[model samples]
Target: MRPPSRSSLILFAAVLLAGCASTSSTQTTPGSVPMTQDSTPLVGTDWRLVSAPGTRAGATLSGAGAATLRFEADRFSMRGPCNRHTGAWSRSGDQLRFGGEGGAVAGTKMLCPPEIMARETALLAAMQQPLTMEFEGPFLRLVAGDGSAWRFDSRDLPPAEGRERIVQVAGQRVPCTGAAPMLCLQIRTQPGAAWQAHYGEIEGFDWQVGVEYVIRVREYTVQDPPADGSSLRWVLEEVLERSP
Candidate 1:
């Protein structure tokens, strides 16, 4: 047997440490670690956000500015771009009922970029819709139908036109702008109508840039219908921004 020496003892300790580190690294690798694929769908499983729309927002999970949703069975907790919110939800097929019990989570007062803030508000409002969930691995994507088949970005929004359509509010031929995405009607109170409602949006698909935009409006009937043929006008609203 080799006689014990201070140098030898130090060498033995180093070798043992090296072995332990190698084993730990190997176990952490994707394949070497034993992983049992969960056959069950993710609806009932508690899932935290693993990826996000942009890094400008910072890492997902564990931050107020971070957008996260921890979903487990029928309950969920969310952290919006500005506030922390959580609520209970129920799912049937693609339809989702998102409000049962939840409140804002208290956290630090950190402000995000304007665009990020806008997107976060829109996303939170959208959660109110009955949702359809698509499961891919550990991710659950929820989608809502706001009657928009396409999406657009802020840059994509066309310049507002000066031309206007002559429509009677109280009863007047007011100048107005009418376009596919934008609709504006100027009212002249003197002529009985003097208010203009301008609405516009653009839509397209550019995944590399991450843009989803839509604008819509819903119309209803008053006790008296306008001279115009239509009694109701519906509009949807959405805006997408390029990831910077």
Candidate 2:
């Protein structure tokens, strides 16, 4: 095509830019519309803290403990570095508020290292404050009134997929009374649950008798079948805690 005169080219460029601007204004960008409290994707989703105010860029939960949050059914559960906290949550537009008489932000009594405790305290304090939430794709940003910002990644698992369950067990090895008797890991799924003999080996865990352990295990179904075999399997995901 022939080159346009300087003025003509400038006018054409201005028109093109204006058209582009108009198109952009009309088109809805992903996450451009703010989500309402009741319709927010934050509910029933898990978020792993990626960054926080006063932290270095790209800061994450790389220490001994994880900083995570899960919002479900008007309540929130958070694991801050060391302690686990739970409370009620309410949102109005972009503002999120935490705590009420019975649903105050309460944390576990477990003591952690000074540094971890400090970080946990900071995170808990931020949650207690009212914050504005913004979503960018799978990422979420929360900004507090004090100008502090927190970042989290949307870590929602598939609907069909099962989640890992963490259970504290008073570990012991017992003999499996089967056709071929073998040693098995005796585990308690919960505090009040009876101890059951687990025949399958938990990967990444070196089981020891008489030791207390907090273990994360993923439950899934197996297709193949064996005589007197259970379809459910519990694969170890992590060892959160262990004590003699």
| Candidate No. with top lDDT | 2
- By TM-score, the best candidate is 2
lDDT, candidate 1, 86-189, per-residue tens:
55555443444555333222233333434446556566556655555555444455656763111111111234323212121211123444433333332221
What would the per-residue lDDT of candidate 2 be over residues 1-244, giving only the tens digit for each residue? 1122210101111111010011112322222334743244776667887776555453335334467788776568887666667766666566666665325666665554344556667766776666788887788888877887877887643353655566555556777865488877777655555678775766556777777676657778778947656667776655555655
Ten contiguous residues minimizing lDDT sum, candidate 2: 14-23
Q: Supply the TM-score for candidate 2.
A: 0.47
- Candidate 1 regions off by >4 Å? 1-64, 100-111, 147-244
Q: Locate the minimum summed-lDDT window of 10 residues in model 1.
A: 14-23
Name the lDDT of candidate 1: 0.35
How much lDDT does each candidate structure score? Answer: 0.35, 0.60
Q: Look at candidate 2 and tell me the lDDT of residue 81.
A: 69
